[model samples]
Target chain A: MSNFTIPVGPLHVALEEPMYFRIDVHGETVNNVTITAGHVHRGVEYLITKRNVFQNVVLTERICSLCSNSHPQAYSMAIEQIAGIRIPARAEYLRAIADEIKRVASHLFNVGVLAHLVGFESLFMHVMEVRERMQDVKESIFGNRMDIGANTIGGVRYDIDPERIGYLREQLAALVPEVDEIIEIYRTDSSILRRTRGIGVLSYDDAIDCGVVGPVARAAGIEYDVRVKAPYAAYDRLDVPVHVLKDGDVWSRAMIRLMEARTAIDLIHQCLDGLPDGPTVAMDERPAIPPGEAIAKCEAPRGELIYYVRMTDSPKPERVKWRVPSFLNWDALGIMLRQAKVSDIAIIVNSIDPCISCTER
Target chain B: MLDTTTIPLAVLLFPGGLFALAFGLALKGLDRRVAARLQGRVGPPLAQPFFDLVKLARKRTMVPDIAAEPVFLGTPLIGAVSMLLAAALVPIPGVYAPNPLLGDLLVLLYLLAVPAVVLMIAGSASGSPFGAIGFSREMALMLAYEGPLVLVVAAVALRVGSFSLSDIVAYQQTHGAFLFDPVMWPALLAFLAFYPANLGIVPFDIPEAETEVLEGPLLEYSGPALGLFKMMSALKAVVVLGLGVALFLPLAPDGPAGLAVHLAKLVVLMLVGVTLLRVSMGRMRIDQAFAFFLKWPLALSVLSLAIVALA
Candidate 1:
């Protein structure tokens, strides 16, 4: 009956990567949760501005292994805005292609962790297996599975050869049926449904109050994806529809990912259909270190990843700060875990795709 | 009865400690294979259990910084002992127990259950929320299944007109194995109801629901201790199958070829249980599992008891 402190994560049990939660419990109920962050801080912001804008592309990509593409894309979007360079139509299209690919892979990885945490080891392994197909696509195009370094300052560094383009389309086309099967497996299957549905209820109002973005926001019926709302890069060219859900629970989060993955496939198909003739990179001179501030938001795998860069025309930026998706999403944990039993914490935490390394950095 | 005084050394070596360990490992492997096949996959090899034990035995044991000392060490010992004691009484068809009283059916059930209980304690004593929650779920599952299982087993004891396991086996041998008694269907239903609870399969496996609870009781069990628990788990599987044989089948190992015949029958019974589990079902939800095992098994057990009382 006495109030007791129960610490979660940071060398404790987790179904996914480690994060910390100091929950004050009264019997079975959690009266309060004090979250302690900064365990995964690598001082990335301090490290990035050390290099020029060109090397910074690769440096920003290193911000997150899972959200690797988004970091570079966001950084480059800021750079493109500053340089006052209108990216070639083809370049914008390719940027969209890279962003969508990363989204699907990252979402798949999160769902796989969710499956693992839920003791649906079969589903976990199966989803990971399906994700390998995406990894193959990444490797063939970008040389890495987790950190696909595709985004560049003015446009994208990578060019898709006709053969590689054919291979990419073939992979996504083959993936569509399997994605549907995964949807059916997660949906029609009773056990998974029982574990996920209503397990972590996040109301629409709370999502906005918490500033939850991307799929979590979508699950909570927030139609505020940076891609659709304030379209940038190739997203402006493509008629991308941001997915949204009313009941923001673990199941809806998973459902959003499934739908988004399907959309990613469709978007890729569109990209290949409208493969432009011009160059992938812009030829015009990239802007000199602009002594101004630039901000850009991206739909990172976890949520809306916001990047803020303040430069004083120095080779390195004067200040760099980012609102990591996990940092923002982790705030929602205390509210979500309040009424639920202790067993649902891992599932609920996993649902938001908490990437400690990415957020802490 | 082949000189009731001194036991043969061969019997001790062949059927006592080594036999129990082998049976435990084999059953553990069998459960994995069966679970895997049902899920449309090929699981680890039959020798995987053996390999796993060897690896666990070799692992360096590190007690968690915040864990209670003996709860860590003592739980696995109790678990293994329960499994060992249960194996000693399971009647292996024709084999004779050096001590048959250890198989006091209820004693066997309690002993087999010790591993899971101790695991929960160990998980909680580790001082982590995730571990504690896992422990909580395991405790809840235990609370749900523990009563229904006892009722079912007690019903069988009533059917045989004795609580002594050997006496029940003897009774079944003489007057048609209680399984063949008119009380068979009800007892069979009760046995089926009790199976998932015993295995912690499907819905009843709330304690170790990895996605949510994160290995429940297993969250704290790492290195050598975890390995011991893992072996104890395999041993527990063997013990459960052994109980299934002793309680449900009640095979009589008597006569000139009684030893060979009874052991063979016990093996066949276990194999059948495995096959039935493989074909019949998948994991159930914790609440549904609680409901099914309690309501159905309690009703069936009550019916079986009624049949025994009337007959």
Candidate 2:
């Protein structure tokens, strides 16, 4: 009943990846939460320097599995900007399709895990089953499931043939209704509402102060999405409606992702319909890199994923630095956990969708 | 009528110890399988709970150095032994009747609470912070649910004019089941709410909310000690569900046919009330769950008591 501290998850089951929290509690209420975030550090920046620009594409994608496509996609975009190369319109659309598909899968996985943390095993299983349709599409088209090897230097690696396009459309149509059903349940279920609503409140002002990205930011009424604001890849050419909610609680964070997944499906359909006819690759010869520095940012499933690439005149060049969305969002956890009951801590932590591996990398 | 000497056999073999253990594990398996099917997956085998028990036994029993070795190791044994005795006190209408010499409905009610108390003691003794959190939640939940349960039992005892479970069964048989009596319906509903919370399933399983506290008191437990806890739960399920059968609806023809009917009723109650409910809803926080029990079930049980008194 007195003041005490509970250390959670350097290797605990509650955490998906290794990270530790020193939670100081007076009785059941959490007084303060101090987090340690270097448990999964792999020294990825040093590893990136060992590989050439061409090989770094594969290496960077391994940074985090959930946001795998965003890493390579951003890295390639940064390199293209530095070298002053223009990708064909067709390749841009292909990259958009891949990114949106990954977004849907990643967001659904986060929501499913929320269900699991709340001890709603059935919903977790059901959501994962719905997300598997996208996984199958990735495997069929891009030839891999998790790391969809879709991004190349100048263009996308795989094209949506007429057969694959038909298959993709069928999968998308099936997925939309299923996702809608799940969203409806999450919105209306009183048990879920009781656990999530008003439980982990990160005010809009605190959100902006912390610079929280993705759904966590959007939930707090921050209307900043890099895809819409900066317009990378095919986003500049297409109309992408950003999803935002006023409440900064766990429920709003979950709802933001669910609504955004629906929009991602719509974006994929538009990308396919607006297919431009041209060579998928801009040139047969690889562009030579000059000494330069460029930064590229993309809207990943979690939030804004930024890559900073600096090139010297060598095969293995200067540095490849990435600032993943989870890095900033993990810092705001202290605000969320302050005064929350011990029982709500897991759901609150999961609400931010903290990617320890992404942050530590 | 069976001789009083067979009470030991009843408690140890036929309807109590081995039989209750097997039936309870099977019910859990069915619950998991049905829940999985509802979610569109091929679930574990019907023998999965038994397999888990076996797996737990094969593992080594670990005693945390910080833990109070006596209380920590002894509570699971105490809990299992209590349920073994309680299962014998439940009379299966025309099939089997417990001897009056072996305690009655009042004793069974007291026995029903031992598992929760054991859990509280076990949690406090484990010396883990999560265990302490679990201990407090377990205590709060117990305070909430126990009041309504006692009132429910009081209502049934008043209706039969005796605290003996066999008399309650006899009264229900001749006068018709309390389940169909509109006056006793409040008690039935109250009891329905009471059992799931007692069983430590979702909506009331905040004490061991796995993601939050990592199985709470049992976090530091492993091997045969953990196996004992599993056995205690399995036996407790049979005692609670069997108690429900005796109190509300104990009407079937004597012999194996009656046993089959009783088993069928337990499976139906477990599948619908526990499994389906667990699948459909997320867990409530401890405070919310505590408030809920006090508001609805408590009021219902008090109403049942007033109805019984008036009749």
Candidate 3:
């Protein structure tokens, strides 16, 4: 077995989105990885500039389905910053609630796919079934599952009532036990540990060098979370615990996500309990736009999501650009995949939870 | 006595050709249904594998431009035909016994190795990178597991002092099944590990891992050519499980009752061993699986042989 190159995907089963990797291997061990992305490039950045400031919120939400909530929320925050509109206390809590709800769903979905990539179908199915409870909560509260149109320019679009609050609490209570059980299984399951632990090791140095964020960064012992580091919405008021692990392996990334999902549920509960009674919007009508630019960052489920918005006299913005977490994390694959077995390629790629749609946008 | 007249009937009708194929397919269907139930989903119909075979047979058999067309097309035929013949060799215990002229245990061992060989040939001949990887992994895995399997068979043969499977069954019948014997437990455990690796399920399915290599050797196969590979595996399920029964636990009242008991054993084995096991574990890397087989099964088989010979 001399050196040979194998293509992983633009359409592989392991990847949720399109991205190709031309891997050079000596026998079964990978010597190098060459990634070719942009299959999912929708010219979204260009499209963002065309849409009005208000319209861009909808367009940005469509950038990535998993982090859909964070996009509009971050974009709106930047818009609010430029307009100098301080949202009511109740809207801040509402925004945080929506953010946490999306975080729970996103993290569980990533870990569930990890189980799937590991070939643990039963665990994968179980995790997905558990995550369905959160999906139901999203649909019930926000009127949709994936893209939960939860953000507006001034505040949140949706608000939770007493009945919805009760429903969410009940779901969370049920979800806690189920998620705890899954965490235990992932912790102790020899099959999972064998395949993941120490397999795709990215050292703390490599992680810092790659500038990976979200669970990928935290798993490598980076004590960074935008919610805590630079709090937005009601995150500063809520107690956000950042879970970090030193292993930086595939298992560590999955474990970090699972732990954060547990924390997100708690954060959601805190927001619901501290609900302030006030107007959901900052103003009675749409405020007039002024010429200005602003930058806003929020902790998305994956990691830090930053949005830059510049407005002119026109309703449409001069430019709207976003730096999604996947952009920084994609660089870490080269280090993780070095000296990796061909079998671990999918698992390692999945560990980053790479958003091709967001990265290529 | 060698009976020439009954050979074709035995091979084609009662226990080998149509019967084995149907029974094997049913086992596959049951495995899928049980696995789905375990995973909390309503799976495909019990006849889904059969429907897939029918659907595949209706599709076109594609040959890649770089592939050795003849060898690529020929390997599945060889694999399917070999399993069909192997199925005839497995005795159904008190219901049907293979004639002495047809061949015995050693011959069955050689035939059992055919599918892996055919896969290796098919893989390389396809001229695909994934197929090449599959070929190498399959070869490594076969090398790792085959040694244990032969030792396991040798232990059983030494215990019974015969290579004839019918004689092994008869000995187990009077002396009680070897499955319950302490000395044979290591061999039984070794066989248990061997079958899953041989059957190519999870934890040992690294070679054809759909996520990793897109079914590897079978990635290039489609239509009736793919249908033949499916049939080969289906028939193989019967032959391998049937072999396990014949060697260790061939205890049943003679006649139709014995046939019923034999079918029952195979279903249980397929559901418990194959279905439950595949759903519960992730696939092991090729090196990990190879190392596992060499370390555990090989050592256990040797221990079983030593214990059985001394006892």
The number of the candidate with the highest lDDT is 3
What C-alpha lDDT do the candidate models reach, one value each?
0.73, 0.90, 0.92
RMSD of 2: 1.1
The per-candidate TM-score of the B chain, in the order shown, comes to 0.84, 0.98, 0.98
Candidate 2 collision pairs? none
Give model 1's DockQ, 2 decimals.
Answer: 0.35
What does candidate 3's lDDT look like per residue over A179-298, in tens digits? 899899989999889989997898899988988899999999999999999999998899999999999999999999999999988998899888999899999899987999999999
Off by over 4 Å in 3: B1-5
Q: For candidate 3, list the clashing residue pairs, or say none.
A: none
Per-residue accuracy of model 2 over A263-322 as CA lDDT, tens digit each: 999999999999998878778987787789999999988899998999998867598888
In model 3, state the lDDT of residue A343: 89
Query: Which one is best on DockQ?
Result: 3
lDDT of 2 at B56: 92
Q: What TM-score, to 2 decimals, does candidate 1 have?
A: 0.87
